[model samples]
Every structure is written in C-alpha cells, then in structure tokens.
Target chain A: MQIQTKAVNGVLTLSLDEKRLDSKLAVGFKDKVGELIASGNRLIVFNLSAVDFIDSSGIGCLVTCLKLMGPKGKITIWGLKPPVESMFKLTRMDRVFTLCSTEEQALQAVNS
Target chain B: MNQVSLTIDSRPENVPLVGACAKEIAGQSFSIDKLSEIEQALVETVNNCIEHAYCGSEDRQITIKYALSKDRLFVEITDQGKGLDPQCLKKLTAELDYNPSDIDCLPEGGFGLNVINSCMDEVNYRREDGKNHWSLTKFVVPLT
Candidate 1:
C-alpha cells in the first residue's frame, strides 16, 4: 500500500494510491498512519479518491488509526467514491469520522 | 449451475484471490454494481474468517465455493476454526435498526456481518461436521 503524503499549512494530507483497501492492506495502512501520528503530525487528511473498495477490516483500520492519534490529534477523510462511501454510511462510520467530498473541504475541517 | 471452488490459507495475503474469483464468477451474470457488491460482501466475510474464525492463524485453510445459476449466485465459505457466536450475530443484525447520531459513540468494529447481510439477498450460518459454513446468496435476473 503506497500512501502519498503532503504538508500544506499545518495539515498533512495522505493520499491512498490504491483501488482496494481490504484485508491485504489494512495493517500496512494502519502502521503508516501510526508512524505519522507518532512523529507529531496529528492533524491529518486522508485522500481516498482512488479507492473504490473497503471492507470491514479496512474501516476498522481507519478507526485504529484515529485512536492511535489520541485526543489532541485530528483526522478527516475525503474523496470517497460512492461504493466506498456507502460502506462508511452503512457501518455508521460516516458519523464517526469527519467526511468531506473534496480535499479542500477536508483540509479546512482539519485546520479548523 | 456453474460452480468454482477455491481453497487457500487463512491469511490476509490470499484475500485478493478470493475477491478476484468472486468478480469473475459473478460478473458473468450480474451488473457492474451488483458485481461490486458481491465482491465487497465476499471480502468482508472472508476477512472476518481470517480475523475471528482462524484468529490470525495462517496455517488453517479457508474454502470458498461459488455457484452461479440463472436466477441466483450462491457462495459458501467454510472454515475449520471455532463456530460462529449467536450473540455476535444478534448484535450485528440489531445494528441495522438505527443509525448512530454521535461521532464519539460510533462503533469501530463489528460491522462485517452487517455488510454481508446488506449486500446479499440471503445469509445463513451453521456449524456442520466440525466446520463453520457461511452461505450467502444474491438474487439476479439474468439478462435475456
């Protein structure tokens, strides 16, 4: 799982460069985000434009990443395709994470 | 009915193979959206078996049998680990009753069965002859 990261202002954007975020990549994804949070980058935006599929484990991994960030840290996700977005909504994770339609919106939410 | 059976180690690395098999089998009859849904449901179910059924034990084996007919697609996932808990099934089925309102109260896990149930037309689980059998069926009207 290759995640591209960029820093703008104070927020770090990590773009998922994969089509599927299933069991195969969930642990790796968590570890990468965990490393980022451990390095003092708390405010984060997950750009999932390229991802079209996410299983329950993938969703669980996202929650694990959020918990790893602790209380002071913040993480938002944006650019979810319809099918992937439906998973979040169906699982009620849409309420758990700050979801945005675009990267700019996610950046704003994380910065605010 | 046309059927294909695949047996793989209970490891995360083999999940994509299962997904690919599902897509290839289901794509022969269903639409793109339905194919995606079937693949997603299969992935969730198989991943659940890997995480909970086998408990991260890669030495175990998981078998997936897919049968496609004119009106329905049937999938059976068999595992040799511990059987499914009725209580977990009850909780997962109950989750479909309402949507949570608070972000802080959102559940991080326990959504695997729900995703499977929501995607497939029929979901059944039973312990038979010391193996856990998960049966999933999706109904589709064949394109004429």
Candidate 2:
C-alpha cells in the first residue's frame, strides 16, 4: 500500500493508493497515521477514493488513528465506495467517523 | 477432498480474497447471520496472524483451510511465525482492567478474539512445527 500526505488549511489529507486495507497493509498504514498524529496534525482527512475494499483490520487501523489523535483531534473520510462503505455500515462505524461526499468536501469539513 | 485450501501472502491486500473465499461458502440463502459471524471471525483471526504472527517478516505465508459439512463448518488458519505463548493468551483473557477504547489495544484488530469467541461455536489454538495453527468452528443454525 502507498500513502501520500498533503496539508492544506491545517487539514492533513492522506490519499491511500491501494485497492484494499486488510491485515497485510494495516500496520504500515497505521504507522503512517501515527507519524501524522505525532507531527501535530490534529485534523485529518482520509481520501479513500481509491480503496475498493476494507476489512475489520483496515477499519481497526482507522480507529487506531482516531484514538491516537485523541479527543481533541478529528479524522474524516471521503469517497468511500461499495464494499468499504458496506463494511463501515456493518460495524456501525459510519456513525463514528465524519463521512463526506468528496475530497474537497472532506477538506472543507476539516478546515472549517 | 474434505476441505478447501487457500494460500494468502502476509500482505494486507489479500484480505478481500480471503474474505471472498469464506463469504462465497457462507453467503448462501438466509446466510446473513452466518455470513456476519464468519466474516467477523475470519477477519479477526486472519488479522491476528497478519499483524502479530509474522510481525516483521516479509517472506512468510499464511495458509487457510476451510471444511464444510452438513452440520458445521471448520476453518483452520496457519501462519509461519513464532507461535503465540499460551501463558500470554491466558493473561489477556484473565485480566479485564483495560478499557477497550483504542483500536490498537485490541487483542485482535478491531473486534479481537472476543468477537471470534462470540461468533464461532468453538475456537482452538495450537503451535506446532514452527507454525501457529488456529481453528474456528460454527454450527449452521437451523431455519426457524
């Protein structure tokens, strides 16, 4: 999995360039999120526009990123497609994270 | 053959393939309950192997075996890594002090073994021949 990070208006936009996030890629992705958190970027916008699938481990990684950010920080998701959205709904995690329609909307939500 | 075997690399990208294999069998008519249980347990168990089993190794493989019968389905997943310590598992189950707030603190990814234990009718673990062998079973619930 490849993770690219860009910051605009205090929102750290993380684009995941992979097809899925399961056990195999969770750790590496977790570390990247950790790095962002450690870098004092409290507001996060995850662009999963490229991710087509996500298992529990993938969801776990995102949850861990949120926990790592603590209560004062926020992480939002944008462009969640089919199976990944199904997963979030199955676990009731869609209610937990901020879900936006597009990357631009996600950045706006976080920036605002 | 009594069972179907699938080989998956230790990479996270194969999670869907593993899930699809299990789901194909479990997602028949009115199999939602079973699908939910199997998906949760399978992901948790497989994630355990992926995140902790081979922790830092890149050349290892995780082998998954599936067996279906009229009454129950059996799943066995094996990983090429240092086996887990029974004593540590005992400690994890024995101690209930930590609040399950953070995802990383979870023993098995998000839902952890608790979900596996709840979803599957039986769960067993053993270490043999330098491999971690974890087994899970679920009985097909009769139609009401």
Candidate 3:
C-alpha cells in the first residue's frame, strides 16, 4: 500500500497514492496506521487528494486509525474529494474528525 | 429499458471493477453528481455478499444485473452463499451516531449496509432459490 509519508515538526502526514480506498486496501491501510502508531506517531494527518472513492471498509479503516490514536492524540484528514466527503458526512464521521481542505490546514489541525 | 448482467468471483479486488461498470451505466441515466453514490451503494452490497454471504471465500460467483428504465436504474446482485440475517436491517438503518469522546465507542466497521441505504433510493435483500439477493434502486434526473 505504497503511502507517501512526511514528517513536519513531529507530526506525520501520510498520503495514500490510490484513487479508490475500498475493501481491498482496507487491511493494509489499517496496518500502516497501526505501524505509525507503534512508531510513536501520536499526531497524524492524512492527505487524500488522490482518493476520489471510498467504501465502508475504507471508512472503517480510518475509524480504526482514529481509535488507535486514542483521545490523547489527534488525526486530521484533508483534501477529500466530493464523493469521499459525501461518504464521511453520510457515515457521520465528519463530527469525529476535522476535515480540512489543504495540507497546511490539516497539519495545523493535528499540530495544534 | 436496457438491462445488462456481469458475474465475477467473490473477492474484494473485483468490487471496484463492478462499481465502475455500475457508474458507467448510471451515467447514461443519471446526472454526474449521482455516479459516486450509485457506485458506492452497489459496492457495499457486493462487499456484503462476499463478506457475509460467501464468508470471504473466493471462487464463488457473485452475479450483478443492471436495468435502466426511463428515470430509474435498478441493480440486483445475487450470490450463492449464505442468506443475510433478518435482524441485520434494523442495525444498519439505525442512526449513525458515535461518541467522539469515547474512542472505543466509535465503530470501526459495519458501515456497509448503512452506507448503501444512505446512497440509494431503495435497498432490499431477499433469499430465494438457495441464493441471497440484494437490490438497489436509484432515480435519475437531468444533468443541469
């Protein structure tokens, strides 16, 4: 699940270079997040500009990451395509995480 | 009215392929805005068929039928696996509420059926002739 990772002032930003984050990649996505958490990354940001489609399994993988982060840490997602945003709202996940528009905004959301 | 059918092995990898076909057919009948929703609904149903019905066992066949009327697109997906639980609908249709304050309370999965219901105009499930059947309907409109 080749994800692009960047560290900015202790916060890590992970970007999945995939168009569709469906069931096929769900396990790998969750595993990656688990690894990040295990590696002492508490504050994390995800850039999802390239992902235009996300199914329920994708959503579940994201929620699993959030849970892994726990209350002490923060996870912000930015660059949601229309369909992905619609899925976030449809599943009422918008209330759980701050959905940002840009990478800077997401980094700032997670950093602060 | 136009109808088309496609069959694929019960695997997670094949879900997006079927979703793409659904979007292509939906494009002719529905506006562009509804394409993702239509595809999402169909994908969820297919995933359920593979996960719950077929129990993630590959090699089994999952059949999908797409029919287009004047203003509506009907999609029916069938699988020769186990039948869906009758009590599942009540759980899937309930309000998708979560407690952000409690991380454990937040649901990590089980959004498939709920998402399908949210996207499509109608979603139904049935069992007949030793097969599990799931149907989805969407009403289309002009592009503008």
Provide the TM-score of chain B versus the true chain B for each model in turn.
Answer: 0.91, 0.81, 0.94
True contacts kept of 2: 0.28
Count of backbone collisions in candidate 3: 0
TM-score for predicted model 1 compared with the true structure: 0.91
Tens digits of per-residue lDDT for model 1, B11-123: 88888888789888878788877887888888888888888888889989999999988899999999999888877787546654434443344466778888888888999
Chain B TM-score, candidate 2?
0.81
Task: For each candidate, give its TM-score against the true structure.
Answer: 0.91, 0.65, 0.96
lDDT, candidate 2, equals 0.75
Q: What DockQ do you compute for every candidate structure?
A: 0.55, 0.25, 0.84
Q: Which stretches of candidate 3 lie over 4 Å from their true place?
A: B142-144
How much lDDT does each candidate structure score? 0.85, 0.75, 0.87
TM-score of chain A of each: 0.96, 0.95, 0.96
Best by TM-score: 3
Task: List runs of model 1 lying over 4 Å from the truth.
Answer: B96-105, B142-144
Q: How do the residues B37-108 of candidate 2 rate in per-residue lDDT, one tens digit apiece?
A: 676678777777876888745567889998877777889999988778676465323423333445344333
How much is A36 displaced in model 1, in angstroms? 1.2
Tens digits of per-residue lDDT for model 3 on A1-112?
A: 7799988789988999999899999998999889989888889899999998998899888888887876777889999999999999988888888999998889878877
What's the distance in Å from true for residue B28, model 3?
Answer: 2.1
Model 3 chain A weakest 10-residue run by lDDT: A66-75
